[model samples]
Target: MANPKELDPAESPQAFYGAELRRLRLAKGLSQEALGALVFCSGAYIGQMESATRQPQKDLSERLDVALGTDGHFTRLYPMVTRSRFADYFTAVRELQEMARTIYEYDPVLVPGLLQTAEYARAVFRAFDPLRLAVETDELVSMRMERAHILHSPTRPRYWVVLDEAVIRRVTGNARVMHGQLAHLAQLVRSNRIVLQVLPFSAGGHPLMQGSLTLMTFVDAPPVAYGEGPYRGQLIDDPAYVENCRWAYDLVRSAALSHEASLALIEAAAEDYASEQD
Candidate 1:
């Protein structure tokens, strides 16, 4: 185990994409602002997409290829970079996933990001980096689905997650995929390896009204709580802060449906979606 090689900004894949985007922009004599205006996105979004800080969606991907007149490079570049899950911002997500012995997750909208179905996860990923094609979305989805293997490892962590009822009801993708997703959601619930609870909208004015959070406790260090929004994320390591978040989670659990009851809710939703499919 020697020191790892330092990565140069010009040598990395991100740099490659960024440099190429910049070259195309300069070659066309278009400013970032001008390119952003044409794409119907912000200048910063254009910058981020070019820097490979975010993936471009299908429409944007095609637009870039045509806008830059690069036969097909940007179109091909979109998926080539979009397939990675944590990407450049949340490398810690993967690091934390590997470190924790017990993972406590609270998802107020959809399923805990970790427990998302392929389609659901893809939708989430697509929502982040909107210019990827279906192939890229599928690739990213596959990468995320494979991450669930941690649940079955020889020394699996104790994973407890709470979901908002709307998560099960908010169908993602087509009716068939939604049906399959609900089934997968129910199957995971029945595995007995996890304790999952669902908080309904009817349980109005709940304690944690904002969004999703996760408290991951490592065997060797103090517990840490991580929170995320659609575009931002934070990792909390301080004892007082983590404790406060844990307390809030404990109260949320009290207000949510019991584990068995939650499973029933998920099962019923799965059947509902399944019935529609038949």
Candidate 2:
């Protein structure tokens, strides 16, 4: 039999959300039987909702609201069919990000999370104020690595990242760690699953000097531009706004190093760091 964990190439988001809800409910110690007792639905009915084989309607949310006794928190079943599960702020962007056929990110300060090496991540995190304890920092690094796992999935998104020269020279980790990361990036380029464009220090003036953004496009939905600062972010779904970001990124890509040149430059940078370590 086929693996239950695999994507159908055309699976609906509703199915994915259902699977998550069921998992979350069970994890929270709610028995299907007990949950059913409160919601006026049989165990089988709850099972159906959990599998995402069943659509969650507004009426069902209203009914579950009264039955679950948690106001609308747990009972407010998300309509994954036409809306994002994320808050109005982030929306279902993460879900969509996972589902995208292609993703493009602009990193003006540091490497985008998807391309970061684990050790490199730790150094970056340490740069944040009020350093976390070692164990806590390790867990945070693990979480970021896990998030990068989506890129390794069979139906993973194709990543195209434009990195600022500042990021390549940020000196996040020890020289050894930085060398390893640059070498790893060159390896990713060889795999051809990723495209890297390096914006040199020479490109002194550009439109994106404002900040960074990650743009994603899915097979079944409109493109989105996610813009963020040090602590704030916004999902731009408006056609005009998204389109504008696209063109701006194009200019940046054009001004950066070409593919072959970028790979050579990365290798050179790695060796330079390796010399520092030695």
Tell me the TM-score of each prediction against the true structure. 0.66, 0.68
Looking at candidate 1, the ten consecutive residues that score lowest on lDDT are 1-10
The lDDT for every candidate, in the order shown, is 0.71, 0.72
Q: Candidate 2, residues 156-271: lDDT per residue as tens digits?
A: 89899988998778787788988988988898889876899899999888879989988887654457788877655666556678899999999999899888888888899999
Instruction: Show the colliding residue pairs in model 1.
Output: 56-131, 56-132, 57-130, 57-131, 57-132, 58-131
Q: Which stretches of candidate 2 lie over 4 Å from their true place?
A: 1-93
lDDT of 1 by residue, 219-274 (tens): 54457777888676766555677899999999888889988888888888877887
TM-score of 1: 0.66
**Cα RMSD of predicted structure 2:** 10.0
Q: For candidate 2, which ten residues in a row score worst on lDDT?
A: 1-10
